[model samples]
Target: MDQWIKTILEEFGAIGVGALMLLENVFPPIPSELVMPWAGYSVSQGKSSFLAIVSAGSAGSFAGAWAWFWFARRIGKERLANWVDAHGAWLTITRDDIERVDHWFNDWGAAAVLLCRMIPGLRTLISVPAGFANMPPEKFSVYTGIGTVAWTALLAAVGLWLGKNYGDLARPLSWVSTAVIACLFSIWVYRLVQQRRTGSPHKVR
Candidate 1:
């Protein structure tokens, strides 16, 4: 997968960065951790400019997040809530879990959108809550843009700093990614155990 990502960035330049970011946002399994840094390393190698890679990556992430927000908006809150209530267990997310996010969005508004884009797991899922809350598209764009640019720039910069050493650091970065995934899995397990002990507010159908 790492080699595949590197090849795309090598062959397609900034466009490949944008495309990968879009897919990453829509499908959370695609790691931006890998994409942004690789693109940055490419820039260091003079394959592309810093501004172009960052801009394309940010644009792609924004578009992918918008896609989810738009879809959730079309679904509407009640129907989505009902679906979640029935089947959220498989995803380890309940309607109540969603409602907590909704409340957090209500409390934090645009800040919530901006900050979440930088978070690994929350980056993509945050869009759904925003959609459910019917946050104005323009507002979403402003915050999401700010957040994605900051995030893309940060990761790309890390790669740029690493330069030729980026290859050496790849294994360490993979381990970090693995640790992140493990932590997320642990959180899910904790949630599941808690749910069993206390019972969910809404019974899964």
Candidate 2:
């Protein structure tokens, strides 16, 4: 993963950063943690500009989020549920969870979409629920844009700072990324456990 990131940074620079962010939002496997910091390192190496990197990353995120939004609109809830039931194993979303997501969309509306972007795994899945709930396109776009920009800027800054440290930056950055992901995962797991214990289902409301 590290070598692939370095190669992309060396070869494609800011464009690579943007593309990765887009893929991360759509696919969920691509890690922005690796991409943004590498872009920062590239800037430190005089290979790219910080503004360009951030811009690309943000644009990619917006595009990806928009795609998901439209997808939700097209598929709607019943069809999506059917599709999930058939292929849910691949994505790991359960029937109960899908129903809960639908409930969240109904209760919290677009704000749930925005908050989901800030979360790790929930980010991609929220789009489906947002679609299921039939959230307003304009509101969804606005909130999604805000979340994407904030996330992109935060990651870019971390990358930039680490880039300055050169050889020393990689280890610390890796450790930090691992810790952050672990913490986020733990919190999510805790919430899931709590929800299960309460018999309140997985939906936020």
Candidate 3:
């Protein structure tokens, strides 16, 4: 990862930042927590502008999300719901849960996309659901851009303030990221069980 990031920074400059952000969305192993802060540190070192970094990151985020959205859109609703019915239990989810989620996603996806983008680990994953729900492309792009840019700004600001200590800052950010993902998964599990036993529609919101 170190060598890969270095390659991106050296080869692509600001564009590389955007490309890596896209990759970060596609591949969870590539963490934005590490990348954005380093971009901030680079700003402190006079290597890049904070605004450029944030814009590039946000653009990359949108592109990556768009890829997922398109993939889900192509997969379509019936097939996905069928897969969920077959495999949801392994993930502690159910088709009924999916129906409720789809209904909610269709109803409130704009806000959902915006809010998830503000979250640490959920931003990219939200796009898949949006696509699965067949959300309007323009609406998805608008909300995604809003949320990704805000998140990029916040992360860049943290990096700018921390500067050289960006390395030090990574530890706690990792913990926070993990905690957030865990919390979300826990909620999904709890909701899955609840809906399964009670036969009710449990909205993600």
Candidate topping TM-score? 1
User: What is candidate 2's local distance difference test score?
Assistant: 0.74
Off by over 4 Å in 2: 165-168, 171-205
The lDDT, on a scale of 0 to 1, for candidate 1 is 0.85
Candidate 3 per-residue lDDT, tens place, 99-187, comes to 66567667775898998887765667677779887789999889888888988888888877876655454455445556655765677
Candidate 1 residue pairs in clash (backbone atoms < 3 Å): none
C-alpha TM-scores of all predictions: 0.82, 0.79, 0.69
TM-score of candidate 3 to 2 decimals: 0.69
What TM-score does structure 2 among the candidates reach?
Answer: 0.79
Task: Kindly give the stretch of ten consecutive residues in candidate 2 with the minimal lDDT sum.
Answer: 196-205
Over the stretch 103-178, how does candidate 1's per-residue lDDT look in tens digits?
A: 8888988899999999987898789889988989999999999999999999999888887655556566556657
Number of colliding residue pairs in model 1: 0
Higher-scoring candidate on lDDT, 1 or 2: 1
